[model samples]
Target: MAFNGKFELESQENFEELMKSLGLSDEVIEKYKDQGKIIEIAQNGNTFQARYNYGSKVITNDLPFGQESEFVSFTGHRVKALAKLEGENKLVITMEGLTAAMELSGDKMIETLTNGVSTVKKIWKRI
Candidate 1:
């Protein structure tokens, strides 16, 4: 359970561009701009449960490695996703046109989300 911890967002890059590319409106993006994000992850074997707290919203997903599962997107849409572990520290998920990769290093977790047009990278520190 290397990813079992609560992590707080430390920094982000190109977040606004990624939101725009995902079809989110300016108003919606602005509302969440300065909000703090906390991610809680629990891993048991090849299955993982993750909870994302974004100020006013919370999203939880159950991911089973190497299997297709349903996960809610940031845009509030349910999508079919497949998740897999890369080596021992990285979890990569593919859904629709987006790819999300979460990697752990020391007490920090780096999350990269890409949708071809834009990419957002967020660094989270375990708390």
Candidate 2:
């Protein structure tokens, strides 16, 4: 599967700004600012399992394309989301107030998260 890999965070943009706009406390934001993050993805057919490792926390989501599923947001809230595959290398997930798109290019995966008010882009390298 194109999305199957263990990726380590390389760099990020607007992460703090987005978190701040989302009402996250400065202490919470600081806690995760320099945290090492890793994402492991396994895709089988149209179904995918994604594991996100953020130093002290690990969140996993089981997603089936075109179906609504329960997903945990970065804010640690459960939300109903629909996952969709765009072409062959991109997976887009839409939740109540957020949209996340993960696109694979070469050995890197670029994840863009938007909450209407702010946007964050994180680049990950396959490890």
User: lDDT of candidate 1 vs native?
Assistant: 0.88
What TM-score should be assigned to candidate 2? 0.91
lDDT of each structure? 0.88, 0.88
Report the C-alpha lDDT of model 1 over 1-127, residue by residue, as the tens digit. 6879999999999999988898889998998766757889998777888887776788899989999999986546899999998988998999988899999999999999999999999999999
Backbone N/Cα/C clashes per model: 0, 0
In TM-score terms, candidate 1 sits at 0.91
lDDT of 2 at 100: 94
Off by over 4 Å in 1: none
lDDT of 2: 0.88
Tell me each candidate's RMSD, in Å, in order: 1.5, 1.5
Candidate 2, which segments miss by more than 4 Å at Cα? none
- Model 2 scores worst on lDDT over the 10 consecutive residues at 72-81
| Residue 22 CA displacement from its true place in model 1, Å | 1.7
